[model samples]
Target: MANTSSAKKMVRKIERRTAVNKARRSRVRTYLRKVEEAIAAGDSTGAQDALKVAQSEMQRAVGHGIFHKNMASRKMSRLSGRIKAIGA
Candidate 1:
């Protein structure tokens, strides 16, 4: 129902942005899941490596506005803590 030209343009922009954001979110989740699986398997080294990758992905999500700064920070903190616990 975008009657105005600007509104129509905005709708298109939003659709594109939504697709990009969804992909980013999915990628981040995949990284996080890998870390979790490694942790669950008791592979400390693997978990640590996966955590590093997940942290980077989460930070990128924040930079891209796909995730809030605090949310990304919180996830990174928790994952790091878990990884440390696995080592200890």
Candidate 2:
């Protein structure tokens, strides 16, 4: 239990932030899934287009402190590599 009013307020604030973060995470995952689906379907052009959108969404998530910069970069790198391999 929160013993102080300040602690209660902090808990409330944390809950709100958690909800927002969850939504952002879900959005980023959705974009990433789109890219994966396009790649799996062997549509390189579509995958590239989806990757463009996913990259922006991912960068935005990183900017919002939802993902670490290096993690985002790594994910983008792997996805781009897959896209390239599909074209090859």
Candidate 3:
């Protein structure tokens, strides 16, 4: 569908970016799942540890433009609140 060479090149670039973004999204989800599992198991320390890793990954994602800034912040806030509630 891309007629021009530039358009074809752009399509290729888009494909590559899509794959990278998918991987990043999956990575973030994996970290989130780990934190949720730890929390569900009622392991406060483990959840805290997982939260640290997850937070880092999430912020990295935000920096990469995979997630909106506000969305990442909200997710981090909710996760932190859950961890705190479990601890308390």
Candidate 4:
């Protein structure tokens, strides 16, 4: 479908970027899952630790353009709130 050499190069770049983005997304999800599991288990300290890591990963993702800034903030907020509620 790519007629020009430039277009072909663009296609290849996109493929590479897609694979990278997919890996980043999966990594973020894994961190989130770890936090969620810790929270569900009612381990406040573990959840807090995981949340810290997850938040770091999320912010890194935002920096990498994988997630919107607001979305990352919202997710971090919700996770922090949940962790706070664990003690209440």
Q: Which scores higher on TM-score, 1 or 3? A: 3
Residue 26, candidate 3: Cα error in Å is 0.3
Candidate 1 achieves a global lDDT of: 0.92
Task: Write model 3 residue lDDT over 1-88, tens digit each, in one string.
Answer: 9999999999999999999999999999999999999999999999999999999999999999999989999998998899899989
**Candidate number that wins on TM-score, 1 or 4:** 4
Q: What TM-score would candidate 4 get against the native?
A: 0.98
Q: Tell me how candidate 2 scores on lDDT.
A: 0.98
TM-score of 1: 0.95
Q: How many angstroms is residue 87 displaced in model 1 relative to the true structure, after the best TM-score fit?
A: 1.3
Residues 11-41, model 4: lDDT tens digits:
9999999999999999999999999999999
Clashes (backbone N, CA, C under 3 Å), per candidate, total 0, 0, 0, 0
Question: What does the lDDT read for residue 26 in candidate 3?
Answer: 100
Per-residue C-alpha lDDT of model 1 across residues 1-88, encoded as one tens digit per residue: 9999999999999999999999999999999999999989989999989988889889999999889999889888898888889889
Q: Regarding lDDT, does 1 or 4 come out ahead? A: 4
- Candidate 2 residue 20 Cα shift, in angstroms, is 0.2
TM values, all candidates: 0.95, 0.97, 0.97, 0.98
What is the lDDT for 30 in model 4?
Answer: 99
